[model samples]
Target: MRLAGIHHVTAITADAPGNRRFYTGLLGMRLVKKTVNQDDVRAYHLFYADGIGAPGTDLTFFDWPVGPRVPGSHDLVRTGLRVAGSDALAWWQDRFARAGVAHGPVEERDGRAV
Candidate 1:
C-alpha cells in the first residue's frame, strides 16, 4: 500500500490547557477538535490545525499530567512548518517574541531561508 501524506502527528503532553494555549493561542493554529483519549477516558486528546482541520495540517496531543519522561533514553523531537519566505520567518519570529516564546534563530535550510 502507498501512503498519501501524514494524517496527523500526535504527542503526549503533561498539560492539556497549556498545550492548547501554546498551539492555538500563540501558534495561531485552530483548535479544531477536543475529545478524550480512547484508551484513557480521563485524559484529553486535543487537535489543532489550520483552517477546516485538513489532513497534513493537524498536530494533536494526548494529555497525561502524571510524570515526566526521561530525556536521554528517547530521541528529542521538533516539529517544523513550511513558511513562504524570509519575510514569513521574520514575521513569525516577531510574533513568537512578542508572545514571549523562545525560538531558534531563522536559518537557511534545504536551499530556502527558514
Candidate 2:
C-alpha cells in the first residue's frame, strides 16, 4: 500500500523540559504521553499533540543528553506545520511574538504558508 501523509515526527532533544515548555506551553499542544525511553531507560520520550492527541498530529521527542551541535547549513532544514487558514497563521505569529519565541514571518511557499 502507498503511504499516506506523515503520522508523526520524532526528533532528539537535549532538554526534555525545555522542549515540553516550548511545544506544550508556548505552542498550545497537549502532553499525550510521558514515558522513559524503553531502550535507554534513563532518558525520556515525550509525545505532544493537538488537544486530543490525534495520530497525525503527534510530535515526539527523545531526551538524549547530547551536546549542542554547531550551527551549520547541512543540518535538518526546517520543521513546518500546516495551519488551516491565514487567520491561524496570524494567531501563531502573534502568539510566538507574545511568548518571546523567535519565528520567521509566515510567507507563501508553493501556494501554502510555511
lDDT of each: 0.85, 0.86
In order of appearance, the predictions have TM-scores of: 0.86, 0.88
Runs in model 2 deviating more than 4 A are: none
In lDDT terms, how accurate is model 1? Answer: 0.85
Question: Candidate 1's residue-wise lDDT over 31-80, tens digit each?
Answer: 99999999999999998889777789988889987565577867446788
Q: Tens-digit lDDT track for model 2 on 1-114?
A: 888889999888889989998888788889999999899989899998899877799988899987657687465636787788989999999988998888999888888876
| Clashing residue pair totals per candidate (backbone < 3 A) | 0, 0
